[model samples]
Target: MPTSDAVLDPAVAARLTRDAAGLVAAVVQQHDTGEVLMLGWMDDEALRRTLTEGRVTFWSRSRQEYWRKGDTSGHAQFVRSVALDCDGDALLVRVEQVGAACHTGDRTCFEAGDLGAVVGAGA
Candidate 1:
């Protein structure tokens, strides 16, 4: 049997604890590098799309719509694997990031120059 999202039952989605906006936390990470790319939220449909479409999709809270990473920016993230946190309230998605993952064109959304400088200074 081919293991595809189409055939994979989504019954687990109902067990997730969503935020007040009906979104579950989704953390995107690079599969090989283990670099955290970005954090997004997903509703049931968004989760379904991400699994079935093979792309990291998120539900935009402000826009109230579904946005697939790299759709317009050409920085698509292909899902390699998905894992549910122990609490079942969060999702970690390992992906193959193509191009910049951040909307600002940075490799990652997290930029802590001060933290890096502080850590390096002590070393």
Candidate 2:
């Protein structure tokens, strides 16, 4: 159920499937390049803000508050588009990134060396 302060569209909210914590995983990407940037979490309020405010907003699980990207870091993400995954439990936020997307000043959060895995053979 949406909170008392909910402002999300009813039709859109009805399609969501929030976790026990009322959050959906939001995967952010570079709008034009399609580079995967980072993942954030969002509750209904955060999603609503991101959709309407032209900036990416996230629900901070650690801080237990709402945070707008690039507010303090100056690495703002301007929302270009947002899409809910088929399951309605995840979100894809395409943005015009201003600076590093990761908190560590990296371009992407997946910058750590990849774990060795068997290469897949395409059909």
Candidate 3:
């Protein structure tokens, strides 16, 4: 569960109050390995489920369903820590991953090579 200090932060609380969408982006990462696993979205229930279950669960925007990160793929993620960005509209979930995090069987979703060298040194 998030500390009271985090959940009670005025900035965080403010962003949590979405317009009519009831959604927020969640960026998932591996805690120990420092690898990005995946990105998903969350609603109030999804947030509660992740905190309560200590697992990485997301609300599927396309399917309109709740997805438990390794439920079918056998790549479950155990929560280690969670943070809200300064704007409080997004979340960073640090987790302990069990297996391949990406559905495509890649270690990370961000597998593209750096193009900074070609993009004027840094884009």
Candidate 4:
């Protein structure tokens, strides 16, 4: 796990610990279009991969591997910026998406509702 040499502020560290098992949720979004691309999980490795590779990579809970979002589907998400929520248990990854963000041939995993309706539904 990555640690800062600087002392961690308790408030910040507390906020970052909602995922007690060392995992967090990452929401991928299109940087230019502002479209939500996909949702995935991240372990420390996944986070490292995204930061290091400059692409969206996730830890598949079911597949139990590090999954690069578009490795197979060709719907690559090129990361733009990563933001952590106030709680820090979740992340928002803005990216420059290449193709369809969904495996089902859709633009985004969140193609159902408008932003107003799904604000708190957990991205």
Candidate 5:
């Protein structure tokens, strides 16, 4: 994996724990409704862009490039806030989602992924 020399706040970078590919998992959510929108990966530079530019940017693992949300789809995610997980291996990106978060035009990626697991008796 190529290292990023892009500028990111030292303090924020220090808290990150990336994977072997030098990427962190980002969980995108609707700021107002708390609905999980989608999942994306981010390198330091992508994270910096998301934080500084007020838009969500992700490092595409397959395409091996950076893509800003809504650039082509017009389904943008306007950033509200971001929080690093306790383990520093993940991030929660809160945004004002404009349209479908899924490439399939679904509201969320998880919307159609229910496995029908047996419900456990729990409070």
Candidate 6:
């Protein structure tokens, strides 16, 4: 759901901060559960395709291709809503995910990482 205040157009793309490789960070979240599934890179075309196609599409930095989530695997992510951060450097994509968002076959990419090591056990 795009709001009138946030337009997904060429102007918006121009305002965003992309790296030298012309990519911005996109964080994908589970719509209902509010679970952050994964982070992917997105170029302007990928962002446009995500809005227009009604599915989450990403610029694969490793493969150097456009990968629509669940395109190759059955675990697809349908766009429930999208929000651009105030800085225009990142996007929060709330999706109705169909299956695992991780390549490792886990429900989410963050599950494998040890949060305790970074955040500390007591803190």
Best by TM-score: 2
- My TM-score estimates for the predictions, one after another, are 0.83, 0.94, 0.77, 0.74, 0.93, 0.85
Ranking by TM-score: 2, 5, 6, 1, 3, 4
Question: What's the true lDDT of residue 66 in model 4?
Answer: 77
lDDT of 4 at 79: 78
- Candidate 2 lowest-lDDT run of ten: 1-10
Which has the better lDDT: candidate 2, or candidate 6?
2
Give candidate 2 regions above 4 Å deviation.
1-6
Residue 6 of model 5: what lDDT?
Answer: 70
Q: Residues 1-123, candidate 5, lDDT per residue (tens digit)? A: 345667889999999999998899999999999999999999999999999999999999999999999999999999999999999999999999988999999999998867999999998
Task: Compare candidates 3 and 5 on TM-score and give the better one.
Answer: 5
How high is the CA lDDT of each candidate model? 0.84, 0.94, 0.78, 0.76, 0.94, 0.87
Off by over 4 Å in 6: 1-8, 117-123
Please provide, for model 3 over 4-52, each residue's C-alpha lDDT reduced to its tens digit, 9 standing for 90 to 100: 3223334445667443567778999889877777888887667767876
The segments of candidate 4 whose C-alpha lies over 4 angstroms from its true place after superposition are 1-15, 18-20, 112-123
Q: Can you give the lDDT of residue 23 in candidate 4?
A: 85
lDDT of 2 by residue, 50-102 (tens): 99999999999999889999999999999999999899999999999999999
Tell me how many residue pairs clash in candidate 6.
0
RMSD of each: 5.7, 1.9, 5.6, 6.3, 1.7, 5.6
Task: Count clashing residue pairs in model 5.
Answer: 0
Clashing pairs in 1: none
